[model samples]
Target: MKRRPRRSVPALLTALVLLAGCVLVTVVTVQLILGERPWISYDAVAATLHDLHWTDLLPAVAGGVLALLGLVLLLAAVLPGAATVLPLDGLFDSGAARGGYRSTLRAAAAGVDGVSAARVKLRTRRVKVRVETSRTQPDGLTDAVRAAVTDRLDRIGPATRPAVAVRVRAPRRTS
Candidate 1:
């Protein structure tokens, strides 16, 4: 039940920046082709660059800020996200299912004979079921819980068949 991670914000920002740059370049090129002076004057730009000081704190700060922004975007794009919802298949309309399947599997395990309570964790590739038993041996309880879980899974017909693991624990007797 793990959904794929995504970094949509960084991608969107990059697309917007590229689009703005393209539009600016296209506008400047069109103005030059029509023999009209664009807003940008090369002489003024060259003069500004010539007078720029290498020790300017503003440019250094701006470069540092840009570098930090790039690092953040890179991390956003690279980091893996925690996903709990998964898309279910094998139906006419695709739909998303969350992790509530654990409850259903737990109930199925609890229904087994000699099981008092059950806990289930359903993952993308595996299903883990734990049961508390007072009268049943751990080995027999594990087998029973595993069979019930298997039957439940077969009935539900999930898109993917993950391996199932069952554990039985003896409940502590009250003094």
Candidate 2:
């Protein structure tokens, strides 16, 4: 079973459109039943519809716009969003949040002797580790941080272990 995050924006918009249409229909129905003039003028709408021709540029442009909007809504509903969690290598369905992995890897990189600060970015197939250090000649700091992060990933045991890329940045001199 593949785990993927789904967006609610499209669904919410569709629901709101349907709700507005229903409310408008209900109000018109109630007004007609009470023998009162509806907010929308039926005569004007009928005249407008009667005047509009299928070959007219306005009607063609309106139809094209509506078709494009419908296509966009359909695509949004069908496509899957980004994954919030990474699946683990287990028999049962299990996963770990990306934030947890990032924090854990950050701690692991920061625990190294020369690393002063560490920032980890967890991507689909790569883990980027950027470390900041005060030492002028931070020679082996990048390797140390990379090993630490790799060890942490091994401990976490994700289904597909992402490649660890480490970058070390020296503290800037504020002269």
| Model 2 Cα lDDT, one tens digit per residue, 62-97 | 999989989989888788765787788878888888
| Model 2 regions lying over 4 Å from their true place | 53-61, 113-117, 132-138, 169-175
For model 2, which pairs clash? Answer: none
Q: What is the lDDT of residue 174 in candidate 1?
A: 57
* Candidate closest to the true structure, highest TM-score: 2
lDDT of 1 by residue, 94-144 (tens): 434445667778889999988888888866689989888887345577888
Worst 10 residues of 2 by lDDT: 1-10
| Global CA lDDT computed for model 1 | 0.78
* Candidate 1 wrongly placed segments (more than 4 Å): 1-83, 171-175
